[model samples]
Target: MKGQLILLDHLTGPDGPVEAAALMRDGRLEDLFIDSDAPRPGAIYRAKADRPVKGQGGMFLTTPDGPAFLRQVKGLSPGAPLLVQVTGHAEPGKAIPVTTKLLFKSRYAIVTPGAPGINVSRQIKDDETRDALLEIAHDTLDGHPIHDHEGGLILRSSCAEAEGDAVAEDIAAMADLAVQVLNDAEGEAEKLTEGDGPHAMAWREWVTPAQIETEAGCFAHHGVHEKIEALFRPEVALGSATVFIEPTRAFTAVDVNTGADTSLAAGLKANLALARDLPRQLRLRGLGGVVILDLAPMPKKDRRSFEGALRAALKTDDTDTVMAGWTPLGNYELQRKRARQPLTDIVTEEMLQ
Candidate 1:
């Protein structure tokens, strides 16, 4: 019962900070008490300086270790897009960015705009998706301009010796976890009252298909189109407000502004809403590290009531989130486990706009 447990999944992000179990033994959940300071384990590679070879577009470097190093890069596939740090003496003291090519020997996955190696063909199972994948692949891999495809690729992991159905199962499990997290957060938020902050909100509006087409056409003409258009679906639009629940290397600072129409009653109502809603957003966002929240400053009496409400909100999040007392500057500090990249990074820019 005290042994270490390492859950591996290809679909899981590069950082596996979130862990769940059916039971906890003597306060040790899954034989590991989640620590905010502990670093997540995954394979990381950096380009070596000596392996430089100049090309027409720019200079590039090959991993001298050959197929073995390439294998390592492929192994990290489906986790997070590989983070490649470019370094060279191009401008003496300055570093030059280089392009990389990730070769996946297993599956011929298509490279999407934001998500590089995401297999749109496999996911959509449609002709348009397949064609898009192939077109992008051929262009990036064998186009006239000689494109650089150096990034993360998904290949079988030699360390785990995972193969056949086992690898597929691992990928499925990771997807399940991600789905479960989202679903559970949504379900929990629905139980709260309107005065309880908006863990999630939906707005309904009537719009003709023609209106959509016209707007989309306008954006497309401007050379601005997003791959993930589902998020923009006007059908019962879902909006959720999240706070920086955790602090990592990049600190999260939230500014709370009292709305123009807010009254004394509405102000207290909003504060209570934020208190109930903030924790859920933190979990949903997967925000880790240090989070600073600037709530609309209230009277001394209201502050005491707000503190209790805030503490209650923190309990809703399944993740190990801790609410530190408010700072002298009227900001409150909280900590959540940093798992994957922020939601803003995950969503498309056009959808955000």
Candidate 2:
């Protein structure tokens, strides 16, 4: 455990350089991040409202990068310039999904404009630590002209282990950036902030102390390439059971199989195992959207335990996911946010070739 490693490297493709990060635990690839040129989910932009779709309750907006779609356009008029943040990766040839609510997130704090309140992450259960972080947040933001007090600060769980000065600096820096970007909103369709790359993201999100590797070809040295390539295939072996994850044009399909296990509880065991690993599988593949899970033939009575395991797994995952319950045919469904570019789509075919 002390020897866990985070490897950061770059891969060249037809599009240009793609930044990559891989987390290795006990000599196995545990997580991965690959950058893409597509519009990132957290990027903020000053966009001009385009024509509203007559049928859909959303309107298309023009950003410097490309067209973006924003829902609930009741107050926005055509040609009006407003701030928006990219909400998710767009489907092929579709407008990038965006929202008017902007959030500036950093390693230690999240600054929310138009939502004023100083809140601390619930993960820090220590009363003394929470009070200390709240005091730091107030000290950093007390007199700052952040959106005329409409800006709120959220001290992230990372602050628990971080130095007070560092946490305060992160909060102050994000608050200042939010104010600056908001003040500069009276302009053409322009990107206010570029999304963080893989290396930066690894630094921010992978807060657990680990051996960091930045040498070139580190991915190849650590066998990350092979692990990633294996994901191109559908089957992932979990002990004697296997989980198959295949993405389609509309949704991702997941199937659980109990390999040669003839025990009565084989189906229930496989389903529970897949439920724990499903989040990591989807996250590494960067596949999101509708997820249809076809679990092995488990007794209906065991569905509650299966759901509990799945919910617990997803609760710890960073991605937003909602379990939509079981279908008539005993299949389960999940709706996951498209927070990253799909691994297959981002890795160029030529590179694989």
Candidate 3:
């Protein structure tokens, strides 16, 4: 199986989410998750410029979707309506990232709101496949043109494998959504206060209902928050290996060990097995930034082999991760870039209150 789907549910208040986190894991593979409460990477919003920071970080703007820090400095003025799309989600103390170059996401393509041309994802790579998808997208949109619509199509990498009918359907659907978004922004007169955007989970409100029906043995659990809380424990054991996951102010450290009576071969095997769960745990726990791995000691000649094995295990991690190599203290250092609060921290906050 590619992955085991773990349904995530959120506890919510009247306005929106109080908690939402989803986890997906398969045998010895990296885990996948969806942080519903966090700002989505592709959703668009119509924001009004607040005030420029004068060569500082960026411009602050308010929108119904969320408050975003716009990096476009020049020609931006206060109280003007501007359409933007979220480029990144929020972190503990920082605002979410956004851009004026808005784009709408689809299963096979991205629909740019006001642009006039189609382009394919550079990662699609093969010239012939890229050209075929481009032709299909342009032809589909041409036959189904909405009058004076500003919709433009850009094929996603996955479209390289998508059937022609699927591509056409997605293009039409995304273009329709884009048009609706543009239509709404013109009439939107809402203003933002500090509390408005931080808690809403927009994706949940928009998810396709068929998604839950399609996955076998993976239905939304009645107690999603409870499941999330259960997995938030600091340590967990798998087979002969016990993992110690501790998050400090600086970084999160994951240590792997076998019971004391084990021989070197057993311990090494345990370490290799633990490698599969390491990336899975990081993602499930929403651990990001610098991470340290402390595995049981191995032969000097085997260090390279262990690192390669660990790399193979982490190849499925969707978040961009880079191995910073080993540290002087005999721990392996890695970096994963993502923005969100850890589930452990979330638990702590609830416990405190």
Clashing pairs in 2: none
46-149, model 1: which lDDT tens digit per residue? 33322222242233222222111222122232222222322111221223332233121222221211223433323335575455444444443342211232
Off by over 4 Å in 2: 1-3, 147-149, 349-353
Q: Over the stretch 1-353, how does candidate 2's per-residue lDDT look in tens digits? A: 34689999988777666788898888877788887878777899999999999888999999998999998789788999999998889989999999988889989999999999999999999999999998898888888999494999888888899999999899988999999988988988899899888898888888877999899898878777778888888999987899899999999999899998999999999999999889989999889999999999988999999999999999878999988998999899999998877889888545533
Q: Estimate each model's TM-score.
A: 0.32, 0.96, 0.68
How many pairs of residues collide in each model?
13, 0, 0
Under the 3 Å rule for N, CA and C atoms, how many clashes does model 3 have? 0
lDDT of each: 0.35, 0.89, 0.63
lDDT of 3 at 212: 28
Q: Could you tell me the TM-score of candidate 3?
A: 0.68
Winner by lDDT: 2
Candidate 1 vs candidate 2, lDDT winner: 2
Poorest stretch of ten by lDDT in candidate 3 = 191-200
Q: Answer with 2 or 3, whichever has the higher TM-score.
A: 2
Please report how far candidate 2 places residue 159 from its true position, in Å.
Answer: 0.7
Question: Clash pairs of candidate 3?
Answer: none
Per-residue lDDT over 1-353 for candidate 3, one digit per residue giving the tens place of the 0 to 100 score? 24443343344334454433343333222222333456556666667888787768579887665567888577877888877777655666766677778666655767776687788888788988988887887777775443356667778766776688888888887777666666666545342122112213222222222222123223233333444554667776877677788888788888887765377676677667777667777776778889888977777667777777779977765567898987787878888876444756444424312
